[model samples]
Target: MGNSQRNDGVQLQDERLRGEQLRDEQLQDEQIRLRRPAGIRSLQLGDVKVTYVPDGAIRLTPRGWLPATTDDVWAEHAAYLDETGHLVASVGGLLVEHGDRALLIDAGVGPLSVPAEPGNAVGAIEGGALLASLAEIGRDPGSIEAVAFTHLHMDHLGWAHHPAPGTDGPAFTSADYLISEPEWTHRHLAEEHGTSEEMLAALEPRVRTVNDGDEIFPGVRVMLTPGHTAGHAAYVITGGGRRLIAFGDAMHSPVQIGHPEWWATVDHDTEQSTSFRRGLVEEMSRPDTIGYGMHFADVVFGRAVRGAAGEGARWEPVDA
Candidate 1:
């Protein structure tokens, strides 16, 4: 072949390679951008409609993830933990609707992020989109009849106290915020752990205390599973003979489904939390029931099924 022909062929090949490279890069960028911004996961339980909305997420080192646990025990569950041995906890809320009324189980971590300090378990985390996610589902925060907090943690009260930017005020203006009486009385303790006074001030006026076993809503009963917090409560929404437990922070990581005794360091009462966790695991394994793990990243909702003996169990995500 002529030298010019050879050179021309080489130039065409180079151009084609460049084009393919550019296309590949664009595809990668699109994947990163369009990646689900981590919001809501909806499912229906007979007559009840449940949604797991994202506030954001937090990273907790295994050592910090379960304060009193040994590293060897965590090592056994490494697959469930990320590379850094950090557990990812979703920061958001659960929406339950039946008939015309809507109830938000927990307020998501508000639109805010903060770095961690020594001795603090929760690393960098940010969330502030609970209001927007609610709107997407055609439910206004004000339309929610009640804001039921699983515990008095900041992540659960974020947007409830701090409204999203440029928003009129607290989004759930008309909703009565509910918490356990013990949790309300010991609200000051949350501050020692990490909750801010500003958050408490914002929640004070709207916060209403409720006792255990109270029927906060139709078919929704409160089970005070205290340990993570003095007043941590899970809501069991029973309707049409089916139930879904919005088990807030009871077991942050689905990995906890396997290691119920490995309590998060942030637990106000680690021993009690572990005890409640064991009972919870058993209850979660029963039929016609599902669990809502607020901090459980992408798979926010699932069923805890019993596995071979010591292995405890596995999480089967529930999508409807």
Candidate 2:
């Protein structure tokens, strides 16, 4: 071959090889993001630190949990599902720390577990490591200043209401339990959703009903976005020119970022929940905002980004 032709051929071959390697790397990343469970992940937002303290995980029946989704949808998004054909959801609370002060967003499913039942929206689930997870990160449960909830759900109130292992009293005795005003006033409705009346009583003394826009902690403010429940609240933490929204059950899976209209079966008001989700997804897509999805499996922390024109937003997982 001529010298010029040989040079061009070699360059083309190198470009092809590089393209293949890039594709392989992207595939590997997607596998890790979709298939694995998340460990305790910590990230910094200026002076404040945010961590996802994993208590446990649950399996959600795709069609049953997200009634708006269909078999075809699951089939196309099989990577998000596990071997058992269920979407894996990480159950835990978000720990926010500023200097020596710490706040826990949710208590997690306490020292308990449940077996999967046929035809149920959820599958086998377990928790109890929240305390241990906290200890591993070197934060004392007692040091937590307050336990703020997005809503009164069993998983979120788990460690708050349930007793510490082998103890008669619940853990974090000194911390106040922060609940949204509406959620507190309509606490009775939580019983139908999974939180028991007994649990409500346990938290009664420490419960402090907060209003929207309340600055519950340094750099953290409550943004009440109900619909998942009567008074669901999302905590917005701002610092160092960036903000993180701990959008509790507003979205249980990363998939919902693209299809916010697919309300979960647990949502108290489907239309409202769907509307909030759409706005939430858009807000999270902003350049300076990140989202924390407590039940987003391994992809707990992510940013929503706009897709092609006419397409909905999609989630891009962020690493600590």
Candidate 3:
């Protein structure tokens, strides 16, 4: 065959190979997307609207995630579990909308999933769809005025610090990153909890430290509820004659809603977690108030209600 013909054949083969590679990549992406959770399924309280944008979900051993819970509790709450028989922790963050501006309570574990780690002390998780869900809610990463991190943890700050491929930079480049003063001060200590010093360093430029009681934004106030971490803070957003408390990691599971004494194994201070949880349950039970348990698994957005017979409180999911 002529040299030109052979050259043309080679070029065609290369193009075909590239096309196949792109198709394979797209297929893999579709599988990941299908595995992710759906749109903003949540509620609104006055001017502020909260959506539980799913990044993904994690499956945890009953014994590891909620050490205090018995098999009976799991059996009772079986409706909340996925088919795998593990407790499905709906992995995502919260989008708090106020007028034209938006604020993210926490960044979900980014586009990465790890297998179950039985040997690890805390347990295992798999997630990474928060960005797409944010887009679904009509809020782009750049549109967020600030990303308020409750604590510096790998799962919570993954997307906040890292930009997805082909993105301009960190998602909220123009937005100020708000973190508690104590949280920022001892951010170094977060390394032990799976956060990297390098990531904290990357966040340093845009990071703005706020006092415990500082009203970070309109109708949004910071309330220091430390225990899970040395500087954990919950953002209380009040508007439209109602209040929503973004209780970040104060409690990991809904079972804690009923049994406030059962603290997560990952809690830095178990006693303090229980103490804060008790008061949280009480505060959440008050009229015209709702608690945003960032990691409460299926029952993420709920109002704590006290039983008429004084049987403590239970959660009622807020439907958006």
Candidate 4:
């Protein structure tokens, strides 16, 4: 072949290699984006519908968050951690709707986001999409009858206190804010744990204390499961033939289902929290029962199932 012909063939090969390299890089970027926490998901409980509306997510330092865990434990279970070497915990609210009335459980972390820092176990927190997510589901903010809280944490109350993105007032300004009676009576406990006075004031006007077993909404009842906080409560929604327990912060990540004793350092009473977690895991493992782990990234909604004899127990993500 002529020298010019040979040179032309070589140039074409180089161009093809560059194109392939670009495509590979693009694919890698997409995968990483998927791994990052964000988005909305829903699952139906018989006739009632439960949706996990996204606000944002946070990274929890594995060892720092769960003091009991060591390098070896994390190494053995690395899939729960993300690219940033932290456990990906989503921050959002669970919507329970029956008929035209709707109830929002936990308002979600608001729009503000932060980078990981030293000393603190939580990393890179941000929120502010709860309202939009609600809208996406064809529900109006004012249409919600109430906002029942699992606890009084800043992340959960972010949208509850802050004004909607475009307005000067909170999105659910008109809805009654239901708090477990114990949580409200001792709101001071949450105050010391990062909850600001400003947030408390924002919620004070609309707060309506509810008791355990109270029927907060149709087919929904409150079950007091304290420990993560002074009076954290989980909601059980039963409709059709199935039930879904929106166990807010009782267990942050699905990994907790396997090792309930590994409580987060932020938990008010680790002993009590562990006890509640064990019972909760068993309760959710039963047939026709599902769990809503709000902080479980990607799988905001899932089921706690009894593992095989060798595998112990684990969580299975139920599409929502």
Model 4: CA > 4 A from native: 1-35
Clash pairs, model 4 backbone: 42-320, 110-127, 110-128, 111-127
RMSD of 3: 16.5
Better of 2 and 4 by TM-score: 2
Q: TM-score each candidate.
A: 0.83, 0.94, 0.82, 0.87
**Each prediction's number of clashing residue pairs:** 5, 0, 2, 4
Number of the top-ranking candidate, with TM-score as the measure:
2
Q: How far is candidate 1 from the true structure (C-alpha RMSD, Å)?
A: 9.8
lDDT of each: 0.79, 0.91, 0.76, 0.85
Model 2, 230-320: lDDT tens per residue? 9999999999899999999999988899899999999999998999999998899999999999999888898999999999888888885
Better by lDDT, candidate 4 or 3? 4
Candidate 2 residue runs with Cα over 4 Å from true position: 1-20
What's the CA error at residue 56 for candidate 3, in Å? 1.5
The deviation in Å at residue 166 for candidate 4 is 4.0
Q: Could you tell me which residue pairs clash in candidate 1?
A: 89-295, 90-295, 110-127, 111-127, 111-128
For model 1, residues 1-320, the per-residue Cα lDDT tens digits are 99999999999999999999999986554333222234578888767788877777787766777766677877775555655556666678888888788999988778887876666677768777777788787887778899999888877888888865667578887899999998899899899766889889888888889988899987889988888888788888887676888887788777778778878877788889889888888888988888878877667777888887666787766776
